[model samples]
Target: MKLHLKAALAAMLCTTMLAAAPLRADNEPAKAATKDTAAMAATAAKAPKSIDDANAWVVVGDVKGFIQKVGEVIGKVRPGTDTSQATTFLGVMLGNPTIGDLPAGSGVAMLILPNGDNIAFAELPEPKAEANAKPAGFALPSTRAEGLTIFGKTQASADAGKALAADVKAKLLGGKRTSSLHVTVPFGRILKEHDKDIRDGIADYIENVMKIQEAGRKMGQPPSVTTATARMLEGEFRVFHKLVSRIKTVEFDLDLTPDGIRTEALFIPEKPVAPKAAPGGQPTVSDAIKLISGQGAMRMAMEFNPEAITTFMEGDLMAVLTEMGLTKDDLGTALKWMKDWNACFGGAAAFDMFTPGSKAFGGQMIVRLRNPETALKMLESMPEMFKASGLTKLYEDMGAPVTIEFKKNAREIKGIPVHELRFNVQAGNVPNQLAASMKMWASGVYQIAAVDNWLLYLVGEGSMEEFIDAVKAKSNPGTAPLAAEKIFGAGGYFYTDYNIGAAMKMMQPALPDDPANAAAKAALQAMSDAMASAPPLLAAAFNDGGRHKVDVIVPLGFLEAVAAGAMKAAAAGNAKMDKAPATTSSATREKSPADQCAENLSKIDGAKEQWALDTSQKFGAEAKWDSLIGDDKYLKRMPVCPDGGVYTIGKVGEPPTCSIGKEKGHALKK
Candidate 1:
């Protein structure tokens, strides 16, 4: 089984590499095809030779070439920018005094052995020594230790490097081989070997936290709150540890293909488990794909296993809710409703973001249902279930009173019963502008309708008519479905496509045209132009056989645009810094005794609040110095008064105070 698994894995890896190859037109010349084949062969030949008995390894090809490519892109975006200074700085830091000169096409690799030891080395060119060579301006210690050459700007660093290299017993790769990037991790082996240590580490951490909680309780924290918090943390950690132990191995590869750069990541399970058949049988065409339109700025489609999801919700989520002070009986109706809704789902859901006729950003969600009536029934029962779940009381306690109103059969859309759901929230202590914005958003007509067994939920600035028109267009035979796009043809459990240029263009007009934003606007335009010719960034996850695989393809143009934008921002910052006048050294300035005392009081108050939060103490809870100011507690150490006056840390939600009166500036300004 293991041998067959290896062969299958190898085939999968090769398929990903082949898929990254650029497509050629039918009429392309034979000579061009020959040249492409030769180039690909040469690239494959550069892959590093496999290490003996290696459990894992990572290889990077042409480190210096990648950096130079970025530099070139930056130069094109911002002319007259001096990248040489940056290059020279890197050379000084990574040159002779460290790992020697890293020239163009230099590759690096790290190999891990079965024993968990690893060694990292770079293919560095020999440093040049000349009479007039530029001085590094610092002395370096050079030594030959453990049959390896080591260099550091200081003796301490050199010693540290020697110590790190001491345990590496395997011979390093020394040949003309390279790759863009490759990484393999023996996750199962690592986890198995270090299982006890990991568990012990987490156990020790929880033990310490529990001790802190106990100390807080002794200092007047509520016993019930501390006990609930401890239970929640312990339960969460147990779930996390179980999830971590299930992995077998993970591999990631990023290769420079003829078209661009393609990255493939594989997550293998410890044991192969066949995927369960979809409920209500699989459709020839996914409902999500049918509903999505390729013209959107961003689109996502996913097929889910409701039974698996609900199992997790019922087990893990229910446990968490119980820890949060809710009984299973309290959540019984909601859980049952959720399970019924899941059962009604036809296994696919999709979301698309686009600019409707109104021109503002808008989005819609479409969920395919196998049983629309059951889904509708569960949806209608949601308000009652929520009311019975005690969630309203929780929200009220959090100062956000929420209300849910559902109007069923509110209207008819194309002979289909349309429903309106109004979810209102009154939030307290928020800024006026934010409150108004929230109100405007919450006041929108949240409409839901079942169109041909697909539940359509519309939001944002788009009108119901506009959304309906879009759905109709998918079946009009004139509009292209998102699945028609070449990128989406490779079917997967989950898929997403993003058009950066389109999204940026959508937001461009919203930006104000001011002198301060001139550079930003120019940079944005450059990025948009660069991405105009680039393909949409695509990501997809597939459960092939038993292993899960994810692939992300990024065109070179997209990377170049990112580099250019970063460079433009950096140049703008440099220009501003050059124009600004020099300022006095604030670090060397002294603070008044009163000011220091006030700062100390502020620190004490902050520590008290943190202590209270960790212990889940309500307002007016007392805090002790031992609980709030110890080395392992909230503050690293207790703050002292600059003057001979004492400080008092008041109860939770109250500020600390100094013996000096507020008239002397020894108190925080109200």
Candidate 2:
């Protein structure tokens, strides 16, 4: 990842305010001359009631005194910086002196950084008996002083820094009687437009520090409110209009000793980490994705965390099919089933056939015709294959033949084909809309690879114009579509490769060529752009459904054309992929974490599976479940059944149907 996650993970501190009632002053309070006694009085009045509830309390007292107290309780403020922080302030307050004093809770004691700045410290409350201030509460404090500048060489200028510190100390102290209170965000660093100005200011601010434990306890929670801002600028970021995003939220309260209704903080942290895998058969799919995405995941451990991986299937096979403009029928026709290659789920190609797919992760394939005229003619002529394949109905219904074939293209061996198809020279008057959408310049290739029956499709990087040449070179006697998905799943974004791009470009002017071709090119371009811009992460996430791959919650429309001969080619070879587990590895997750979670699902095994099954049943009706469920090898492989037991939603002969007969009824080629 080019983006260093650590830097991004670093939290941001903004202008979060903690209300400290100083002078009971209104926003428009009158300014008064700086006075040491007044500041001392202010510091003593608002000491926090307890430590555990430090959110609302700002620690106040002389820097030396506050340090001494913190030292007495929590041990010396971490050495290096804290020691020098008190010294800088003493130089300005008393001039040419190091202000280390015996403890007392008064003087320039508190520095506050409150509210939205994004940091909080939960200090343990002090023992109840010793103090009088109410039991406990959370408080914020101001850490920056507007007038403090470190470069003031003159004595008068130095004292001004002192005065600003005194001012912050008084304002940060709320008006309560007595007790110890510590400030949250300490104003230790300064942000200045001038580099020199910034360094000098921080040096001085640190020197005048009032220490009271930094880095509060951070408990885990789903990040309820997620804010995404362009970091292109410093300090200034464009925030989404809606403050809370990604999760539903509600506000409630727990009783913390009343400091009189101090605002409470409740935030849901990042959502339960994205699901990994759920049980079914062998090495977990969740583990596969993690490894595919370059993450280390032990299949043995993840298989047990079923709920954790509920959403982890890396491919949206349905979306991938739909985008490629295919139906379950088209998919069945496209696959190159190898009964012996059971490891691939009867699949016959390695995932690396395409750019993103690989042996372990996953992959895709597509098909094309050697001649569009012949291809269309075949579509019209063999209504049985289309009807039987269930593809004709899909194209007729969706008015397109788009499908997304993803996974690293794995076909490197010479001779084998990845995609194949018959030509329809008749050009069955497909509507202009459908015609424009169907053209990815794939028909030419399909004609070349369809010489063999066992050969579902042929794989190649050559021109479609050579498809006929390829057929001439073919030495097969069987007459049926060739199973060559691995060959076609050769790269990413159909337009990405030189051969496809050049061929398409060469035909660009001719293709939707004149007035008729214009519309086709425009629609194709629009479709291509949308698919190409999807996040890189998602491309690798192509699983049984599109959801596994995208951050933005997308529905099925997520798939689009750019898929075709290529898509069928990749998927045909899906089950054939093989990945040897990494060996002699350094990043293997310690089996320790796995052991800790061993019984997680065991406790709720029956219930969890029931829920999944129940939920699947409920949504199954609405989801066009027949076409959407990839876990079922039969369905994923054969959209139709011979027994006629499942459901018949496809056109006349197509594998029964693509519908489960529940919702959306049956979609057949009109």
The lDDT for every candidate, in the order shown, is: 0.59, 0.27
What is the TM-score (0 to 1) of candidate 1? 0.59
What are the clash counts of all predictions, listed in order?
A: 1, 143
lDDT of candidate 2 over 431-479, digit per residue (tens): 3433643442333232223322211232223233233333344311222
Model 1 Cα lDDT, one tens digit per residue, 576-651: 5465445322331266778667767766866776676555454566778888756477876667666777888877
Whose TM-score is greatest here?
Answer: 1
For candidate 1, the C-alpha RMSD (Å) to the true structure equals: 15.1
Candidate 2, residue 479: the lDDT equals: 22
Instruction: Report how far off residue 115 is in candidate 1 (Å).
Output: 13
How much does candidate 2 score in TM-score? 0.21
